[model samples]
Target: MSGGVDSAVAAARAVEAGHEVVGVHLALSRAGGTLRTGSRGCCTIEDAMDARRVADRLGIPFYVWDFSERFRDDVIEDFVSEYRAGRTPNPCMRCNERIKFAALLERALELGFDAVCTGHYAILRDGENGLELHRSSEEAKDQSYVLGVLTADQLAHCLFPLGETPSKALVRAEAEARGLAVASKPDSYDICFIPDGDTRGWLAEKVGTAPGEIVDRSGAVVGSHDGAHAFTVGQRKGLRLGVPAPDGKPRFVLEVRPVSNTVVVGPREALAIAELAGARFTWAGTAPDAPHEEFACDVQVRAHADPVPAVAVVRDGELVIRPDEPLHGVAPGQTAVVYAGTRVLGQCTIDRTVSAVPAAV
Candidate 1:
């Protein structure tokens, strides 16, 4: 339990189902004493206490596992490295992939646990092929995108008790009925490590600023930024470019070349991506047999973003996604989750993209 209402209620439901359940809260960082200024952080001391209280109420043993070092190496360092490589990464997905499912699940299994349960809002079903991951009944709260990196073996030993829970309010109501104190706890919305949500500031402290030139699509220097790492593809607001485009149209960040410390800005249309190629692909269940070279599926590039119809193919050791329609702002290092309707097929880390706009000679 993350010391939240949903997880508390999930524990309750799991216990009610007549299964022996123990609550395990992960201590992800050394900043345990840090106060949660807003409802956008997890693993704080307050959250741990809340989780302990819920475990007490549920009559289950609770333990706080310290995984700070592993988290820093896998998730935090990965975040920094991806940004330094001029790519935007979803650290939450990395946390789910590396820490929660891999590290915690392995530990739980060694302790004779049949499965690791969490409060994620995704459905697990036994399909003909094997176990399948599906979106939650609550569409708005669906988290299958983040969990898409799990392999078939991982999905087999996982349980999500809140997948069918109609809504967040219902989970809170269940928590209240069970006399849980965290029924009204605000949901965490920001990156857990960056509690204050000042990503740029936090990154700047870790990766020192390097002055860089901001050039337009035509290779003309339009402005300058403190660092290319501070910007991301599809970003528009913070460019602070002093010059306007010749066509008098607003420009967007088209690319971040960290090697040369250059930020490329251009017309918004330049951000449109017609296809994407991803490496490190993982299937949630069994990889389906492809009679042909390509198959049809829905691809979601970001959490909470709508999945777009696409054609998928594995060629040259990369999962290639060709969206039926153009997708904008697809950056390297972001996850591209594939799904067939509501069933999550798998996901891969985007390595590159094919822009819709032709390159200038």
Candidate 2:
């Protein structure tokens, strides 16, 4: 349980299904006194206490497993290294892939547990081929994009009871009916480790900032910044450029080149991406029968963004995708989740992109 309404309700459903269920709360941070600041952070000491209460009410075993060291080495360090390399990474994806599923699930099976169930809003169905991962009935709460890293073996031992639920309001109501204390608790949002949600400030402390030049498409210096790591693709509000665009239009961050300590700004249209490919890829259940042949699929670049029609293929040991329409503001280190209708196909860490607009010669 996560000390939230969704997880509490999931635990209740699992118990009602007549299976021996145990509530396990992961302690991702070593700071035992860390507490949630409103709904901004999660998995704190307070959340553990709330989870224990729910387990007690359900008359099941509860334990707080310390995965802090592994989390720091995998998720936190990876976040810093990616930013240092001028890439924007999804920490939640890494947490789910490395810490939650890999580390936690491994321990659960060793302890004679059948599966590691959670409150994630996704579905698992027994397809003709094997186990298939699909989106949840609740469109607004669908989280299959983040779970695309799970392999065939992992999905076989997983259970998500809330996949068919129509809405989150119904989950909250069920929790209240069960007398769970966290029925009305606010859902956690931003990154868990960064409680204040100031990623730039936190990154600055880890990777010391240095003054850098901001340039345009034609190699013309436009402005200066304290650090190139502080900016991301498509950001436009805080440029503070000394020179304005020739047409009096606003310029957006197009790229961050950490090697030269430079930030590139340009017209918004330059952000359109024509093609993307990555070597680091994984399939959700099974690899395509003809991996080298092009296949139709929908690609999602962000967690909540709508998927776009695309053609994908595995070539030269990398997964390459070309969207029907140009993708805007996509950056390296971001995950591209491929899907066939509601079923998740796989995902890749975008290593590079080809801009739709040609550079000025």
Candidate 3:
């Protein structure tokens, strides 16, 4: 339940629906700490206790499953590897893909459970093609972007009780009405492992600092940074570049070249991306049947970001998306979620990009 109001309300709704539900709280961290350092992260011991209390209130069996080892191997290591490869990854997506849906769901099904229920704010509906994933009624809290990596089989055995909840405030109100203590628990914002939200500091400890040069488009060294892994595409702040552009305008990080140990900075215009190519594509329901080579769709690159109008095609085992308008700061390792209206088609892990700017003539 994550010891949050949303999940508590979801459990209540499930109970009210007359389904036999059991609460399972995953212990994601191996550390023996009970206190949360900040108001972020979901694996604190206090969170487990809160979840247990809710399960007690609901009069359902509760169990804390130790998934720490798998989580580290799958989510944590993948985060480090992606950064080392100079790609910006969304670890939350990885957690949802590898740990929650794949690992936990498999175990649940083996234990004779029909479906795995969670507090995610997305809807599962029976579409013409069978099962389909859709955005939550609460637009601001929509999490379909992260859950887009789920395949059709995974969606078939999943449930989201709060998908139709009007808003987060209503969820909290429902928890209060049910006398759940977690109704006022603050939502987690930072990455679960990096509770303090010091991503650069945490990465530096793991990836180590390899001093590198920060260069501009002309290959002129503009500044230096502790490591290329510390920066991301389209980043403007923290460059520590004392020199300004020739026109006295600011510059942004256009790329992170880990092999060269270089952070490429340039005019913001250089960050514009025309196309993205991704591997490891997965469809939520059925694959789209395009009469032609390409079809129109909406592509979302980041969580809670607006989906852009685009043309998509599958080529040689990869998904390619061409935005009708140029996008900026699209990084490798980020997910490209495809959608038709509000229905989530599928997602791909971006591996390459095509810049909008033409090469020097």
Off by over 4 Å in 2: none
Predictions: Cα RMSD each? 1.1, 1.0, 1.3
Compared with the true structure, what per-residue lDDT tens digits does model 1 show for residues 208-287?
99888999877899999998999999998988888988889888999999999999988888889999988789889988
TM-score per candidate, in order? Answer: 0.98, 0.98, 0.98
Give the C-alpha miss distance for residue 75 in model 2, angstroms: 0.2
**Clashing residue pairs for model 1:** none
Q: All models: lDDT? A: 0.91, 0.93, 0.90
The runs of at least 3 residues in candidate 1 whose Cα sits more than 4 Å from the true structure, single-residue gaps closed, are none
* Superposition error at 174 for model 1 (Å): 1.0
How well does candidate 1 match the true structure in TM-score terms? Answer: 0.98
lDDT of 3 by residue, 238-315 (tens): 999967789888899988899999998888888889999887888888889861379899999999799999999998
Q: How many backbone clashes does candidate 2 have?
A: 0
Query: Looking at model 1, how many pairs of residues clash?
Result: 0
